[model samples]
Target: MSEPEIRLQAWETHIEEFGTQQYGLSFDTLIKAVGKGPRAAHKLARRLKKSGRAHVVRIDYGSPGPWRNSKNFDEPGAAPHGPLWMFADRQIAWGYLEFDPGEWHPKASTAAHLTAVTELRLALTGLDTDPQVWTSERLLRRRLKTESGLAGIHIHDAWFQDFADPDKVWAVEVELSRKFGDGRLTRSLSAALEAAERNDLCGVLYFVRGDGLRRAVEGAATRLAHQRNLDRLPNLEIHDLDATLARKGVR
Candidate 1:
């Protein structure tokens, strides 16, 4: 393929993946995905915006800023102050993307978590066994509403298949903070393990931040295993989120 065609193909993939995310992607995240320097990535983004294939929104505290005269594209030195990018509504209308443009806006508390999830997705691309399938939480929720078998099951942050093992699907959970209280964590874990055993998934992989949260998850897993008289609760795996991102040069 010609250089221009290759670049266009990359942009198409980037835009499609951006639609999968609940919230739009940050400029830094875009740069990482495109494998380009800041200035080049910004230029390409500007072209995409000009062509009406992408939408840009300035976000402050996870809310859209005033629409008028918002900095739609970021300059190279702007660093973290850049706006987020999403597929234009036309893309959805044309049936080219599954993401609902109306759901582009995210709550302030969830912005960071969503960004972390995106980072994890990008990091997976660098692995030896790259993802064969990646279904975002938004897409998974939509499926749950229509698929009878998915009802009452734990909805993971994302579901993916490793390229090396196409038949085995895995659940991904990005836990930035403690979300469950009381016995909720254990109950939730139990449900997930049971679902995995039912052939919904081959295993669950948790990318968690903080030592306390890791210990909590481990404790819950141990309790469940002991109660069930099993050596382990499925193929459960947990990793330090920050370290994993750093190793992949995604942080």
Candidate 2:
């Protein structure tokens, strides 16, 4: 087989072994994984799709713009795009919950979704072991039914945790375009933070898109800590997306 095919096979094996079907790899992540340039990666992906080896999902997130095929490659106005790619055989073999590619709603925020995708990519590329990615749907299923009244404690866009010990995890909340200091955000995060503290997980990491968002998250975390009567906020860490990607060795 060729080098790109070999890389594709390796990525497939990783996904199968790691059971990351729920959060399918993104176009950028696929490019990085295959160590290929944009044109080559896009060509490989198109080939994979033709061979029934991959599935794709493209969304506009309530916007009216052509999808970005690659960093600099744009899909034509007449043609649609696919940003999320999943290996078909591996997803089924791993017994992961399946969903149709067409089910992606255009109303959701793509910026937030992209942030989660970046976090997943960073964990996959940077960590020694494959991380367990938990979306809000997964967390909702894990909510307690009994009397803490914590049914709606979903504060994270995605949760990244070591598969070996899930409690040693990061509750990743993405602040893409929203003001992190919003009251609703603070209230929801306060509950989740309390739960994280009680569970003694690694910590909650707020992935903000800008300095202003970072400051807002930090300030909110501080206020929550004081309100909860904590000496120090050990369960909160805020980072900018560029810093995270840089640390993960992604350009």
Candidate 1 segments whose C-alpha is farther than 4 A from its true place? 1-23, 61-87, 98-103, 126-132, 149-153
Candidate 2, residues 1-251, lDDT tens digits: the string is 63354235665445433323333455656666555576666676665555555555564444454454443233445455445444444434334443332332222345346535555445544422333444432332334323357655444455566567765776666666654444866776686676666655577776677787677767677777788798658778777776777676775
**Clash totals, every prediction:** 0, 0
State, as a TM-score between 0 and 1, how close model 2 is to the true structure.
0.65
* Model 1: lDDT to the true structure: 0.66
Q: lDDT of candidate 2 vs native?
A: 0.54
TM-scores for all candidates: the values are 0.75, 0.65
- Cα RMSD of all models vs. native, in order, equals 6.0, 6.3
Off by over 4 Å in 2: 1-8, 15-22, 62-112, 123-151, 158-167, 180-182
